[model samples]
Target: MNRKIIFTENAPGAIGYYSQAIASNGLVYTAGQIPLDPQTGEIVSSDFSEQVKQTLNNIESVLVASGTDLSKSIKLTVFITNLSNYPELNAVFKKQFDGIDPPARSVVEVSALPKDVSIEIDCIAAL
Candidate 1:
């Protein structure tokens, strides 16, 4: 089986040793994306919703690089620093995942995340 590493300048580059996404079998799995801006190389915002929006956009870029997109995503994992932001996060997801069945998802509240960002998201998408 052939596996392809996915990368794009539209999203923030990986800070460590990992591809932004990988295509294998029939799916594209993405690394967790935070709110870092590709252009400035900094977290976009401190607000929870803003961070989520940026993270989603970053993940979208990775998916596009893999020749797929969030609309075709099969599963998602959201790591958040605060569960209190869950309702707002759902609103953002509803906006982004609009017109689609919405993928299977697991949201976890973690004590901390890289760069002290509020959220990080990753997904598996179908090609």
Candidate 2:
């Protein structure tokens, strides 16, 4: 199984000992992405909606670096600090997916997340 690491300047750099994403066989698996801005490496905003957007954008960047895009996503696992924000997440997904069939997704409410951010997301997509 051939494997390749994926990276992109359009996304925030990994804060730990991990690549942004990895492509193996015909699939790309991305690391969990927080709401950090790619250029500044800071949380994009304190708002839940903004954090969800930034996290998805980060996942998009990783997928693109792996020769795929968000439309090719097979699945996504979202971690959020508050389950009450699920509606906002769905609203963002509605816009992001638009006319296309959205990927399979799971939204989990955790007690906390890295950087004290409100949300994080990771995806699997076809290469």
State TM-scores per candidate. 0.97, 0.98
Over 4 Å off, model 2:
none
Candidate 2 versus the native: TM-score?
0.98
lDDT of 1 at 115: 94
lDDT per residue (tens digit) for residues 1-127 in model 1: 9799998999999988998998999999999999999999999988889999999999999999899889999999999999999999999999998888999999999999999999999999999
- Candidate 1 runs further than 4 Å off: none
lDDT of 2 by residue, 2-80 (tens): 9999889999999999999999999999999999999999999999889888898999988988888999999999999
| CA-lDDT, candidates in order | 0.94, 0.93
RMSD of each: 0.7, 0.6
Residue 10: error of model 1 in Å? Answer: 0.6
